[model samples]
Target: MKATEVLADAYERIAEVVHDAVEGLSAEELNARIDPKANSITWLVWHLTRVQDDHVAEASGLERVWTAQDWFTRFALPLPAAATGYGHTPRQVGTVLVESGELLLGYFDAVHEQSTGFIRGLTATDLERVVDAGWDPPVTLGVRLVSVLADDLQHAGQAAFVRGALQRR
Candidate 1:
């Protein structure tokens, strides 16, 4: 498989894990913040979904989905000026309790669909193009894609921990 294809597959795998972890959680369970330092499952899901949306927009050279819609507001988090950072803390804002699992699932599903679609359209030459964030060193699209996929996977593992914690409670 090509580089972009691998990234898409990686995202799908992570999504499946996260999806399973949140499957049986009620609203309260989804928002359970066992450790303040670590984000709850709700926060992890929102943050990861936003990243996927932002990355797809960046890769396609289009406007970010979050900017077009009140995604942060919908999640009841403080909307950042741009998609540069995490949208909001689900645990702090208590929006997760207000949002049903179905709604959150729909948002995540949309992010995944858009990201996969963008990745599938990328050529190897496109992946080689560099994105200059101007903070650190410039990173190629392929590298950023891999990093984002890895981040999502890490958060999925965290989500599993959140689920286990909820089950125990």
Candidate 2:
């Protein structure tokens, strides 16, 4: 299969697993503390969606999808005026506001759907073109897409781990 096709397939599979992971969770369960070092299921879902939005912007040369100034503009989230910070805690990252696991997963799937469309619109030629992503070495569209996919898979594992810990509690 071609590289674009491979990326699309990988994204679809990753999204499916994410959907399964949050299947039966309630808002409280979704927001439950997994561990001091870990995030809740809701946080993982939002983080995945945000990751996709950032990746899409990088790969398509577009604007950032979910800005800190408007975190709830999409996915039916309530907008927050200031939602940016850096730290290890879920609160520091603002992952604590995710009220419902179902909503979080649904929003994530929507982002995946849109991301797949964005990916499909690209040509193989589009993939190899280099862009100034404001990084030290810069990056290609294809590289960014691959990075998004890898990050998604990695976080999916993290989400599962959180789920397992929740089960243990």
Candidate 3:
């Protein structure tokens, strides 16, 4: 398989996991926190989607799906347009309130489409191109894509765990 195909598959798995985590969850459940300091399922999913949208857009030199698609306004979140839930405090996490799973899922689906499109268009040479220079080893497109996959998958798993915990309660 092509390298980009592999990456696209990984991203597709994230979308599946996210769907599993949020499916059938009530708005209250999505916003419920197992612990006051822990992130709610809603927050986790939203954060992961935002992070993916931000990183992939940057790597692809395209506008973030969040902004390009007006997801921030659709979400009507309390934060600024650029907020991605990274470094969000417990209080900040609590601010991610959505009325329905569809809202989160809709945004995620849009982002996943955009992410896969960017990945699909990438060439082997494109993957080798540097996207960020802040690190000791400059971050290449491939490295950044892997980083995003790792981060999104971690959050998706966390959301699944939270859903299980909520189910048990």
Candidate 4:
């Protein structure tokens, strides 16, 4: 399969994992922190989605679904519009609470859809284009996309583990 198609499939699988992680969990369960320093399921889901939205939008030169669709307003988070949960302290992680699993899933779904669309429109040449210059070796679109996918998958797994912990509790 082509590079874009591979990315689309990977993203779709990540979306499924994310959905399952939060599925049927209450806000209380999602917001539950097993340890004082651990990130909550709500925060994990939100952060993962936010990172995907931010990175993909930057690569695509499109507005993030968060601001484009006013998800920040819906979330009513205390942080600024630019917060993507990177480098969040324990205190900052605790602040990410949602009313319900549906709300988190809604944002995830929207962001995933936008990301999938962007991936679908990408060609081999587009994937080969350099998108970041901070690193010694500038990042390519494909590398950036893979990085986002890896982060999202890790967070989604963490969320699922949190859900399982809550269930056993």
Candidate 5:
């Protein structure tokens, strides 16, 4: 199979998990942390989406949906406009509020659409191109995408786990 197809499929799986984790959850459930220091479903989904938006945008030279579509304004989060939840402390995680599950899904769907669109156009050569030079072996477009996918999948699963745990409690 082509690299583009593989990339697109990977994104699709992540979206499924993300949707399952957030769909039908009330605002309280989305925002509720399993413990005082744990991340909420809201935080996990938001962080994963933000990371995907930021990384994929950088790799594709496209604008992030967060700023391009003014989702930052919509969220009206207390933190800075650039906050993507990386290194967010427990206190900061508590601040990722949403009124409903739909808001979370809306943002995730926007990001997923943008991301898949970009990936569908990539050639193998494009994936081979270096996107970052700070790392020891540097980072290629392929590596960067895989990294993002791994992170997103892990967080999506965490969100799903949080949802199940919340329901159990």
Candidate 6:
């Protein structure tokens, strides 16, 4: 398989887990935290989606789905317009509650559409281009995309775990 295909597949896995973790869950379940300081399924999915929307948009030189599509307004969270849930504390995490699983899935699916579209068009040379220069060695498009994929997968898995735990509670 091509490198782009592999990347797309990796992201697709995150979407699968995201959907599984949130589908049919009620507001209370989605927003439930195992501990007072723990992350909720809602928060995990939203944060992962936001991070993907932010990073992929930056690397592709495209507008973030969050702002470009007015998702920030839709979410109405008491956070910055560009908030990606990075470094968010427990209180901040609780503020990411959604009315339903569908809202989270809608935003995630929108981001996935944009991310996959941008990624599928990239060549090996495109992947080598520096997307961020702040890092010690500078960050290439490939590295940045991989980083987002890893983060999204981790959060997705966390959401799944939270779901399982909540179900068994």
lDDT of 6: 0.92
Model 4 ranges with Cα > 4 A deviation: none
How high is the CA lDDT of each candidate model? 0.72, 0.69, 0.94, 0.95, 0.94, 0.92
- lDDT tens per residue, model 3, 1-169: 9998999999999999999999998999999999999999999999999999999888887899898888889999989999999899989999999999999999999999989988998888999999999998999999999999999999999999999999999
Candidate 2: Cα lDDT at 35: 64
Q: Name the TM-score of candidate 4.
A: 0.98
Flag regions of model 6 displaced more than 4 Å.
none
What is the Cα-based lDDT of residue 16 in candidate 6? 90
Writing each residue's lDDT as its tens digit, candidate 5 over 1-169 gives 9987998999999999999899888999999998999999999999999999999999899999998999898888998878899999999999999999888899999999999999999999999999999998999999999999999999999999999999998
Model 1 agreement with the true structure over 42-110: per-residue lDDT tens digits: 777766777777776776786666656555556555444454335454444343343567767777887
Candidate 6 displacement at residue 122 in angstroms: 0.9
What are the TM-scores, per candidate, against the unseen true structure? Answer: 0.83, 0.80, 0.98, 0.98, 0.98, 0.98
Candidate 5 residue pairs in backbone clash: none
Give the range where candidate 1 is weakest over 10 consecutive residues by summed lDDT: 89-98
Lowest-lDDT window of 10 residues in candidate 6?
52-61
In terms of lDDT, the poorest run of 10 residues in model 2 is 79-88
